[model samples]
Target: MSPTLEFSFRIAITVDAPTIVSSDPARGKRQLIPILGGEVSGALEGHVLPGGVDSQFIQPDGLCRLSARYALATKDGTVYIENNGIRRLPSAFTANLFGDDMGFFKHVPVEDIYFKATPTFEVDDPRLHWLTESVFICDAKRTPDTVNLDMYRVL
Candidate 1:
């Protein structure tokens, strides 16, 4: 059988407003999204401190590609996390402009977007040495102020 997956952890990432870097007709919309703070729960519990950013590229095909680099402090020590993913936002859902106003729209539920990410953890702490060599993937979701993720390890 092929290698299976094992639950790793869930990261609740807080964020500030995104800063759009550039709008290009051919390349797409470039963005630098600041990561404020949040927490990591589940198998590995920790906190996602501030001072990180998620770089996003919005394609005309409704797919937004992202490369997020951040740091997390686990019980073992500080671990650097690099997460890359893609998110699909339908035009109809994001047509209305709102800032953290998803709760008010009871008529529409959270956008059923296709979001997936591959996260790699780098740490020197012996307690979490295994994470450095592990292969992990995540299910990514985003709210106005937060990006919720559930990471799994290939086992």
Candidate 2:
């Protein structure tokens, strides 16, 4: 049987500028993007805690592998999130997107890129244990200063 997806929630994450950690030709470019907090809506409502980080490795061809770690504070309790994903852009837009100039990100058509993620949740509250028991995926989008994620549960 084919699995179906149910919309879970959406997270609008505010971010700071990317800090380039290394630029080795063989290993690709490494960067760290700080999470400045944001909001969550839909089934799960909360505020993203500050100090989270999104670490990325961009290949020469413009494929980015990203891992983001953050926390959400809700009425039920605090949930920790680890989201990992890949973003593939057209070769022509690679340099501008990954380079010091990120103005291109604002202009690129979302249809031309592939951005997706899988997120795992950890919560201490028994009431929120459902999050840890289910498998979740996310459709992600990137803006000049924010990353928006529409999460779905796999069933």
Candidate 3:
């Protein structure tokens, strides 16, 4: 039988401007989006501090990939979460891509794109350390200024 996953909660993260680092024709487009600041609610509560970043890649095939590293500080202590994910855009959305106009990514219909990720937590506080021992998944969403993730733990 398949494993059952428990629903945790949603974490809405706000991001700052993305600094495009590379745009090589052979390699995928790379950009580093800064973590401006945000909050965590639902099962776990805390604030997402500044200084973390999401290093993203957009492949030539139009696939969107994400590599994000950030920290969360709860009332008790802190933990670091590393998230990796992939996004698939609807065919209609992909057909409209052009040069220098990636802005559409921020406004795509929520139902038109699919995003998913696996996240690992590095925890030091014993109370919250159980996070490091579980398997987690996130349904990630992106807006012009934020990233919304609904996380779940696999049991």
Candidate 4:
């Protein structure tokens, strides 16, 4: 008899700010935009891409939504599979991508940050496996500030 397959993986992403050049707000608060030219280290199981690079995402309205060109994995970090197609964030989400208090670019020193990720299929490549959507939040320039990993998974 054939055995069922289990897949999974874990990601450790280090996020930093100051990708784009911007001046402080004239009178209101300001938040730092994230730079995506960092390192992505992790292991994949079911369907995933071993090593891939992410691009800078800047929404037309000025909200940045970066896309990671990678795949999903199974539970055990053994089986890697490909996704059917791409995915995208709903218009509602993109409308206020950075405005969301739970998302990035919050000027407040939040004790907790939130993240959300979806999938897009516009860049379909057989070489890679599944595409994913992810989100995260971090404290704004606080001593105890940290980049939080809100979510990461195949969509």
Candidate 5:
């Protein structure tokens, strides 16, 4: 029997409060937290779009989706939040690693926040490979809890 290979990574996040020009209460709350011991989904060549862009597609693949639920707290204990979510990235950024938009963030923000995740395998498929080691900044307008952002791996 082949021994299972588990891929792991360490994630570091920095959250800052919104700038003076922008009026968001969550701005300037710079924080960095590290999440150790995470798992990944099967990796593939991703998918191509109408505009001729390739992405690590996870829509149809059952093995490439990750749902993480974890907790975070400030050293002072003044703030605490539950960090959890499922996310992925386009293959272009991971493939090239350089461009105007790396597809890492769906949106930018300013907020009082700390980010981390506890990764687990939701599906079982040997052919699938997971790749989620970057931090994302999704837009507050599109999601709930504008001040709190959820982070995840590429899977």
Candidate 6:
């Protein structure tokens, strides 16, 4: 049987500038984008805590592998999340196209890119324990200064 997806929640994450670590021809470019703060809504409602970061490895071909860690504060308790995903640039845009200008990605058409992630949740509150057992998938869109995600639970 085919699995179905149910809408879980949405997170609108504000971010600061990305710090480019290094550009290696063999390994790719590494960057860290800081998470400032944001809001969550839908099935889960909360505020995203500050100080989290999204670490990225951009390959020569413009494929980005990203891992983001952050926390959410709800009325009940806090939920820790680790989301990992891949983003593929449009065929017309290559890694060399942006070069050292990582900010150029902010202008890319979000609809044209393949950006998706699987998020794992950890929570201490028994009331929110359902989040720990379910599998989640998220679709992400990136703006100039924010990253928005719509999360869905797999069933």
lDDT assessment of candidate 3:
0.81
Instruction: Give lDDT per model, in order.
Output: 0.78, 0.89, 0.81, 0.32, 0.25, 0.88
Candidate 5: worst 10 consecutive residues by lDDT? Answer: 47-56
Ranking by lDDT: 2, 6, 3, 1, 4, 5
Candidate 6 off by > 4 Å: 96-102
lDDT of 3 by residue, 1-155 (tens): 79887888677898876788777545667788889779888778988988999888878666878899999888768878899998888766654332444567766887678899999998878888778888999988877667898899998
**How much is the lDDT of residue 152 in candidate 4?**
38
Most lDDT-accurate candidate: 2
Give lDDT tens digits, candidate 5, residues 1-155. 64433333222222222122222222211112222221211222211111111111123221122222232222212111223332333433232212222233443222321223343322133232222233323222111211222223432
For each candidate in turn, the TM-score is 0.85, 0.95, 0.88, 0.29, 0.20, 0.92
Candidate 1, superposed: residue stretches over 4 Å from native: 24-27, 94-111
Summed over model 4, clashes come to 28
Tens digits of per-residue lDDT, candidate 6, 1-76, equal 9999999999999999788888875678888989999999998899999999999988877789999999999877
Clashing pairs in 3: none
lDDT of 2 by residue, 1-155 (tens): 99999998999999998899987655689999999999999888999999999999999877899999999998789989999999998787877754765657888887787899999999989988999888999999887778899999999
Q: What's model 1's overall lDDT? A: 0.78
Best by TM-score: 2
Each candidate structure's count of clashing pairs:
0, 0, 0, 28, 18, 0
TM-score, predicted candidate 2 vs. hidden true structure: 0.95
Better of 3 and 4 by TM-score: 3
- Compared to the true structure, candidate 6 yields what TM-score? 0.92
